[model samples]
Structures are given as C-alpha cells and as structure tokens.
Target: MSDPVTFALTVLALLLGAAVLTALFSGAKALTSVAHVPLVIACGLSALLAIFLVSKVAGADTPQFVSAPVTWFAAGKFAANFTIAVDPLSAMMLAMITFIATFIAVFSSGYMRGEHGEPDAGYVRYFAVMSLFVFCMCGLVLANNFLLLVGFWEGVGLCSYLLVGYYYDKPSAAAAARKAFLVTRLGDTGFLLGIMLLWKLGGWHTDLTALFDHIAKNPPPTEQITAACLLLFCGAVGKSAQFPLYVWLPDAMEGPTPVSALIHAATMVTAGVYLVARCAPLFALAPDAQAVVAWAGGITALLAAFIALAQTDLKRVLAYSTVSQLGFMFLALGTLGAVSPVFAVVAAMFHLFTHAFFKALLFLASGSVMHAMGNVIDMRRFGGLRTVMPTTHLTFLCGAAALAGLPLLSGFWSKDLVLESLQFGAHSGHPHAGSFYLLMLVAMLTAGLTAFYTFRAYFLTFWGPTVVPEEAGHHAHESPSVMTVPLIVLAAGALFVGIVAEPFTHWFSGFVGRTPSIGLAAKLAGAAEVAHHFNWGIAGVSTLLAVGGVALAYMAYGAGGPERVPVPLAGVFALSRNKLYVDEVYEGAFVKPAEWLAVMARVFDLLLDSVSRVIAAVPRLVGVAVRPIQNGLVQFYALSMALGLAVFLSFVVFRAGR
Candidate 1:
C-alpha cells in the first residue's frame, strides 16, 4: 500500500477498534477510565498522517495518490469497491478535522470525567461513539468513489444522530436527534438521486476520476448537468444547515457541548461543503447551479446572522454563527462561475480549514464555562466570569476575536478570501455578475452582523459585574489543566493558523489548486477570471465593517447602552429574537399539512378495515343460518331421506310424461 492508503486504513482501524473495545468495557469503570487514551492517540496519529500526506502531495509529480481498489461486488459493467485516494483538498480537510478532534478528545476526557477526576456515567459509551464518528468522517473524506463516499456519508449522518442524542433519556435530545436525521435525509435523497443521474450520464462509472473523465470526453447536456448539480446541492443545504433545513442545528445543542463542537465544526456540517468542493467539475459546467449555490449561501448567511443577534443561549449563538459561517463558504463557492474554479474551491476550503479550529475552540470554551457554572449556559443566568475563570475567559476571547474576523487572525485571512472571491465574481463579465454584486453586498452586511453578535455574546457572558446563578455556588472556577491545555492549543490555532498558511504568498491556494478535479473544473469554466491575490479595497471595506460592528457591540453591551430595547425598535427586536418565526413558518407550510394528511390516511385505513370485517362475517352468518339442518338425529335424518326419495320419484315421473 502507498503511504496515504496505509495511513488512512490504519487510522480507521485504530478508531474502530477503540470504539468496539470501549463499548465492550462500558460497564467497567476501571477500563472505561482509560478509553480516551486510544482516542487521543488515534486522532493525533490521523492529524500527523494528514499533514505528511499533504506535504508529499504538494511535492509529488501527481496531484493525488490512490491505492488499488478492493472490489466488494460486481455485475457486468458495474462494481462497488473500497478505495482510498488523498488529494490536496481531502488532505486539507483531514488535517483540520483530525487536528481539532485530537484536542476535542483530550477535552472530552476532562469533561466526561468530572472536574474532580471521577468518571461520569456513560463515559465509556461517549468515547465509543465519538471514535466511531471520527472513523466515519475519515472514511468519507478518503473515499475515492461516489458509491464509497455515499456509504460513509450515511455513516457520518448515523453517527451524528447517535452523538446528538447521547442523553437518550432526555426527550429534547431524542427529538433533536430525530429532527437532524430526518431533515438531512431529505437532502440525502436528492444527493442520491443526483449521484445516480451522474452515474447514468457518465457511462456507469462511480469512481470519481473515471466519471469525470467520461463526462469530459462525452459531455452531457447543460441542463442535465445543471439538474444533477443542483440536486447534489440539496444535501449540502441540509447538512450545512441552510435556510429551511437549518432548524435542526440550534436544537442539537441539547446534546453535549463536545458533540456540538464535532458536529458544527469538524465532522457533520463540513461534509456538505466537502461534497460541493469535491464535485467542482460538475458544478463548474453548470453556471445555473453555481448561481443557485451563491444565492442560497448569501441568503443563509444574512438570515442566520440576524437571528444570532437576538439569541441568549451561549451555544445557540455559536450554532447560528456556524450556520452563518457556512453560508460564507457557500458564497465563496457560488463565485465559481465568475472566477477560476481553482480560486473559488481554494477560497471556500481555506475558510473551512480555518473555521474548524476557532469554532471548535469556542464550543469547547463554552463547555469550560458550562463546567464552571454547573452546566448553566444561558447568558441570562450567569455573568461576569472574567475574574472567576481567567483562563477560559482569555481563550474564549481569542476564539471570539478570530470569529469576528479581527485583522491578522485566522478568520480575517479566510473571510477576506471569501469576500475577495465574491468581489471578483461581481465583475468577472459573467451574465450573473449583477447578482454576484448583490451577493457581495449581502456578504459585507453579514460580516458586520457576524462581528456584532460574536462580541455581543462575549460581553454578555464575561464582561458584566459578577452575577453567578444559584446553580453555580461559590466554588465555580476554571477547568482543570487537562481541559484548559487544549483550549490554549486551539486558541493558538485560532490566532496564527491563517498567518502561517500565508494567504498573501498564495501558498495555500497553490497547494489546494493542484487538485485534479479543480483543474478539470477550470478547463470547463474557460477563460478564468484574473483576480488579485490581495485586494486592499475589499479588505479595507470588510475590516471597517467588522470594526464598526465590534464598536457597536461594545457600546451596546460593554459600555452600558440601554439594557432594554427602545420602544421604536421593539418589533424588530422581537422578530430577530424569535428567529423571524422561521420554524413557525415551516410548521404552517409543511408540518401541519403533512400531519393532516397522516390523520386522513389513518381514517381511510380504519374504513377499509371495517369493510373487510363485514365481508369476513358472511361465512359465519351462513354457518349460523344452517345450524338446524346440521342437527345430528337418527330419526330426523331418516325422515328427511324418505321425503327426498318421494320428491325424486315425483320429479322422475313428471320428466317421463313430458
């Protein structure tokens, strides 16, 4: 096996083994106490392997490395196989995911084990499921074919369902799990159909390389390509939590905070963005699909930011922030039609890589706060934690700064790439340039909103006078070294990962651009838009917006602006606070109607069952009516026989006379 292949399989084995072993020993506290050891090792090994593969690929003659596929099944021209292929894009994802997961595992050990170092209930089960989720996610990223990808894709979703409902006894947790599963599956259906369409259109090849080759050789109609691409985007929309399908994500905070970090940052949500980036060839050919991507992402970004402005729950604020940030990624992707496919893919992926670090940091930081506060996360319930938990307060501030796109931070670099991409798209001479321009404006507005909400949450949680809720007694303090250490490491990532990657040098862009599919996408796009690597104007505008937002947030929350809303703006506050009633709209538009249909179907089924019962009674009624004739009496039988014989003789005489 090649290096990438060996590393991929080994990582999978380690995680799978850990999951099984931890599960078998869940009842044994002694055994379960050490479960996180294997997880940390496995995740850490994956991170190292990913970095190694990325470096090798960057210097290799080929853009990717693929191992010999092991065929699972075959019939004539169709076959499904297990294959591992690593490219710049997947490698980047691997590095980000596993890196964050390693820290998360370390943090979880401290988290699941109480602050006093005693193992909490279900500690072993938690690690077991967490390992399984990482395994599934790695498989999804390493998959070489659509068939294999979809398998791991569903596996990731299944693991997400389990993780989100970790507290199965809690009704909210269970319901949230179901909602996440069902909603994502709705998009997965479209994704599957799209895959099948592509298979048919691309000469029955499920291997991504072969499929792309076939499509390039014998191009499908533009409309067919567009339809397939759009269908695939449906899965992205749901998994990434955009618009109508986004309801599940906020509710998913009912799970453990670590689970939220994994789902929202590294694993489940990122899958959708990965899918779209992986299939750039198809989307590049479909301008209409690209436009749709851009529009959906822009609208989602703006809407989620607005909603974030009014949220009170600590994790819910970050949850909406994740939704909004994902919108930014999609917005970058939507610029595909207006710029080089390589440029757009790199821009979106760069953000994904950077986002994993800070988002995970913020969530884990929230976990730290929850630990200190006896699990009280509502900002309304707790205040003034800066002096109480100094370490957590400082690390959380780093994450918040990055998330707000402060200059020289991780988010600053990546978000500028996204905005720069959109700006290029606006003037790329494409027919949809006008629409792209509009999207860029929306994105600019969203940037300010992002900064505002992020800082607002920060100030509300940590800057006010000390007011710890009753849940947290006088003993509230910083998390232990096991937890805070990871926070510090991740805080470093949030602060420097982008600068180290060197956005100005175009190193990240060049490395990810070597991806074969990205090259193919560029060919399909034709006459690539020539855009600058750094645009000071766009950067300045975005920086100003971010700064302005931060200032506004400081004035509103930190500098003692009115605690209560102004009467004139109360209605707007209500709307934003209520998430613009999106859930209610969905209930009225889709849920209520489906529920009514279900009720009618149940009534119809009962009616049919009644009719069947009446028909079934006929045989019983006939048997009852003939009961007298069936009486077993010897004399009665003889009389009946004599009467029958006399009747027969009369009938015979009458026939003879006739």
Candidate 2:
C-alpha cells in the first residue's frame, strides 16, 4: 500500500485497542496480567515490523500514498488530522521504535516479574504506557502535518512524563518527571511558533506532502523560511535536549531502567532528528539557522561528553551520553550537503539505531545487577562480578565496547561515519560547517573521554574483587534467559551491525533520497570485515585512548573492589561526581530566572487585579456624585441631553476641519 501513515495508525489503533480489550475481556486470572501484555506486544511488534519492511521497500519512489485522515474535530478553517503517512523516514523510525520497545517488553517479562507486590503490576502499567508510547512515536513520525505531528509529539512527551514518574512513591522520581516535562515545554513553545510560521507562509497547504509540493513549485519569502527554521530548531532543541535546554536528561534516570532504555535510547529523543530529516528541503535554504544549529550541536557534544566523563551514577552517564550523541546527529544535519546530506542523515540514523541497541543493553544489564544486589547502582558498591553473574558482566562488557566505538562494533561504524562527515564537511564550503580538522580533533578527544568514563563504570561495577557485602545474596546469580537473551541479541546486533553498515546504509537511503557514500576501504573490505586501511593511525590512537582509560580506571577503582578506590574522589565528590556542575549552572542561569519570572507574573497579576478593582470602585463612587447632580429630575435629564448634543456637534465640526 502507498499509504504508510494510514496503515501505521490502523496498526497502532489495532494494537492498543486490542491490548485494552484483552485486559478487559480476559479478566484478572484468565490472561494473567502483564504476561498477557508482553505476549500481546510481541504479536504487535511482529506485525508492525512485517508492515514496515513491506511498506518501506514497496513505496520507495511512489508518492501515490492515500490520505486516511481521521479528524478529531472539524471546523471551517482549522481541523485536526490524526494523519499518518509513512514514507521511508517514518517507516524506518517505526521499525526502530517498535522493535526496541518489543525487546524491552520481552525483557521486562522476567526483569519486572517481581517488582511490585502483584506479580505483574509494573509490567501491566508499563505495557499500557509502552504500547501507547509506540503508537505516539509511530503516529508522530508518520504524521502528514505539523498539527498531527505535534499531537503525537506531545503524546510521546506525556508518556515520557508518566513512565519517568512511574515510581510515584519516590519523590525524586516524580520530581525528575516534572523537571523533564517543564523543561521540554519551554522548548515546545518554539516548536509551536515554527508550526504557526509555516502555516502562515503557506496557508491552505500545511500537510507534509502539500508543503513539499508547494515549495517544490515556489519557494516562500526568505524571512518566513528563516523564522520557520529557528522555530523548528527550538522544538528540536527541546525534544532532543541540547545546549541550553538539556538540563533534564541526566535526572531522567530516575525512571525504571526499561523506561530509560526505551524512552531515552530508542524513541522519544530521536524525534527531533526525524523532523529535520523530513523537512530537509526547508532547512537547506536556511543558512543562518543551520549555522545556529551547528554551533549549538558542536558545543553540546563537546560539553556533554565531558560531563558524562565525570558522572558516577550508571544510568546518568548514559543519559548524558545520549544527549551528547544527539548533538552529533544535529551537527551532521547542520552540515548538510557539505558531505552528502544523505550520508550525514544515514550516519546519524544508523547511530540512532546502534545507540538504541547498545544503550538499551547497558541499561538492562545494569538493571540485572541492581536487581541482584538490592538496587545498588553505586559503582563503588560493586566489583568482580565476572563469576557471580557472567551473563550480565559479559553483556555489559560487550555493550561497553560497542559504546566506546572500538573497531567493528555497531557504534564504531556509525560514530566514526558521523565524525568523518564532519571532518570532510568544511571543504565543501557550506556556511554551516567549521574547520573540519578542529572538529575532528574535538571529536577524537570526546571519543577518548567517552571510552574512559564508560570503561570506568564497567570496571568498577564488574571487574574487581566483590565490594558488595559477602552476604548480599548467595543467590546473586545470572538473570533468566528472558533477560540474558535480549542482551545477547543486542550484543550480537552491536557487534555485527557495523560489519554490515553498507547494507543498513543502503536500506536507510530509502528515506534520505541520495546515493550512499562509498568509503573505498569499507567497500574493498566488502562490509563483512573490519578494514583499517584509510585511517589506521586515527584508529590506533583512538583505541589507545580507550585502553589507557580502562587501565587507569582499573588501577584506581578495580583494586580489590569498589571499597579500595580513593575515598577523596568518593561520596561528596559532588562537583566532578555530579558531572562538572552543569546541572547547577543551568539551575543558576535559566531555571532560577524562569522561576523568578513566574513569581513576578503572579505578583503582577495580584497587584494589577487589586488596582483594577480599586479603580472600578472609584467609578462606582463617582456614580454616587453624578446621581446627586441629577436627583430624580426630568429637567436635569433634558439639560444634560442638550449639553451632550452641543458637545457632539462641536467635536464633529472640529474633527472635520482638522
């Protein structure tokens, strides 16, 4: 079918509606709660993947897609389109969101089995939210209009809030959710403004195909286009969590591990890049806006990479890493056409794919450990878990290697591709690019820091003597195959995805509409082997950095166990320990000022309302004086009417002359 949007919505509607109905009709004991949910999602995920594969390849060149707009309301001028239209980009995103979500769903069957008092309360709630989340992401990416996308965008954000605050009993968890929502809303205003500008520029043509169709024939005024670009960037920054607006991601770890895995790693955070990719034509003409994007993304990547280096909490590190990685994606978008936009987009999207696998793997492995050790995530409370939980330790190590961008891992291919694009970008003379060499140097350094910090976390948690009290759990063992299987699957994906990057790149090109770049060495190696012919020196240097970092971490933290680490760098190491105080700086700069402005708004409203009431009373008091002037007298009314007539005539005469 040409109509991917309609197909996706129908699919989501069926999946969610069926899940709810099953929950109702199956009764409490018949379906056995969350077990039913995982099974249901498995079925839905499989169906969606089948559809995505069939549709993505089928409709690569044809735009004869049918519109199946389900209107929420209809008015003369404004009506909402629950519009779904899956082109290549949308199809690809749908595949990712559903696939990873399904993995989390399946993995959770075992991980979440005993979380709440009821054997499956957490999974049941998680499934409902997760299914809704998948629906939102699919709907968002496939939406044919800005309004439709916004509806689904906000839907995804809403689920982000709910899932983040899933542990409502934990005040910190609830606060983290609030923080994320509030911070994102700040950026969403820009997104809305951009949408409005877009509508204004091309009224009666705001749908995706229509906008492209209109612009294809006639470009809008430069001012309108630039404004739209800025506004969209605002939305992107908010959703993607960049630069000034990125304060919330680190705290996002307060959510459940699976929630963190799904929401942050795979789906919600990538929406911004999808938006940019979908509307690349518009952004292509907005040079100034692209420059802003480049600077913002470059600074964010460099900044967040360093912050991630200093974080101690396992998931927080990944949170900052996600933010940093997203910056790299935006940076590529900024340099569009410099090095084929298709290549950039493919690299970014592939990174998104690989990051989802490895990041989710890391989070779930950490979850296994936390479950084993009574929810202890502090790296210092762990050590030498190679024996106790071989599966988790090995899985974490594999995920860590992938994340560190070592050789043939999925992350290595994607990340280096992004960097290579940035490296070659400036030569193309796009105003959006900077000195490629400098950017490459900066990127290389960031890679080193990323490797170091990631390995530090890995080593402290699983490579030394057991720092966990010996009595923690004699049964502290490997998780079930349900959990380990997902890890294995992700690890396998992470390992070989790079080796086959060429095919993935080819598959991804169905969206970006450009031929994939052929790195000669890569092609010669045939996508089946790791070849280091072109940039062997860079590879050796970067690899050395990672290994060195791991060695240092081993010396410092892996001595015996976590307890042997230097105490000075422990506990109240709030600055380095808390990620270079970036959060504090943000609080001091933006959050506090916003809070103050809110307070001022409240105070101003109170004062203005009180003054307005007092002014209103004065008019009433003056009415008493006027009443005395005309105390029940028809003669007084007649005199006042005559005076008013005379004044009106005089004013009319004066205005005519003037």
Which one wins on lDDT?
A: 1
Task: For each candidate in the order shown, give its overall lDDT on alpha carbons.
Answer: 0.88, 0.71
Model 2, runs deviating above 4 Å: 1-7, 22-32, 35-48, 51-74, 77-80, 115-123, 469-474, 503-548, 551-560, 563-575, 593-658
Worst 10 residues of 2 by lDDT: 516-525
lDDT comparing candidate 1 with the true structure: 0.88
Give the per-residue lDDT digits (tens) of candidate 2, residues 1-658: 3345445656666656645654463346545554446445544554566356545545556533446667766689877665556555555666666767667777776766664325554555666676677777777876777887898899999989998998888999999999999989988999998888777676556676666656545678767787898898888898889988888877888888878888887779888877777777677666677667767877788788777765667788888888888887887676655665556566677778788888888888888887777676766566778888998888889989988888778777777767766765766666545655667677777777788778878877787675564445555677778788888877787787666644434544444343112222122212222211235565677677767766766676655453343577554344556666777787898879989999999999999999999999998999987877767889988998999999999999999999
Cα TM-score per model: 0.95, 0.83
lDDT of 1 at 256: 91
Residue 494, model 1, lDDT: 94
